[model samples]
Target: MPGIGPLLGAEFLAATSGDMSLFGSADRLATYAGPAPTPHDSGRVSGNLHRPTRYHRGLQRVFYMSAMSSIHFCPESRRFYQRKRSEGKRHTQAVLALARRRVNVLWALLRDGRRFEPAQPATGTA
Candidate 1:
């Protein structure tokens, strides 16, 4: 029953490029918008990690759609998609990885005024 105001509610739709970029990248924006997935990985498998919690449906839709959209619109994200696919990860599986990775990038972008950059391979840190 709360957040009924247009500003506080779901009435806001992006109207321009500037408005969209204001969130830095989709992941941070999705996180702020809410509904980002709760990653549940212990070793290899992901996506179907845990039972769904009491999260806002609207927020989840926002993040999911935004992640999918970025796959088409965001160049860096698209490259990640291809890379994940090349690594033998399935489509949805790769997307979930991207979403989880986006959460961290988004958090950082929101904290600092930088855009999301894909991580480079580590040098013998393993």
Candidate 2:
């Protein structure tokens, strides 16, 4: 919820109605949001990733925007984006990857009935 404003939060709720169980898994949720690239294998071209024609574009927009917003305000998320950029990923590609990753984290948080908490940096080895 770090980047999810009232509009994004309401959109997410309207899209899922807080029913995390209905999707069965985070991967499924990502696909529903149109980010989980589907395999487009043909001949020698194998494991090619492409978006499905039938997907909720609005929901996808919500996640994409949330990820973009987080990049500015969340340190961990900004670090993750920077890592992706350093690894040669383009802006859209990096943001979509982050959004997909967020799907898994949000799923687990909801499943565990927990709120989002910023990770504390390690002070030293115990």
TM-score of each: 0.49, 0.87
| Each prediction's whole-model lDDT (CA) | 0.57, 0.89
User: Which candidate has the top score in lDDT?
Assistant: 2
Off by over 4 Å in 2: 39-41, 44-50, 124-126
In model 1, pairs of residues that clash are 28-106
Task: Put down candidate 2 lDDT per residue, 1-126, tens digits, no spaces.
Answer: 678889998899899887888899998898888956679899999989886788888889988999999999999999999999999999999999889888888888888989999999889978
State which candidate has the highest TM-score.
2
Q: How far is 93's C-alpha from truth in model 1 (Å)? A: 1.3
Question: What is the alpha-carbon RMSD of candidate 1 to the true structure?
Answer: 10.9
Q: Could you report the Cα RMSD, in angstroms, for every candidate shown?
A: 10.9, 2.4
Clashes of 1: 1
TM-score of 2: 0.87
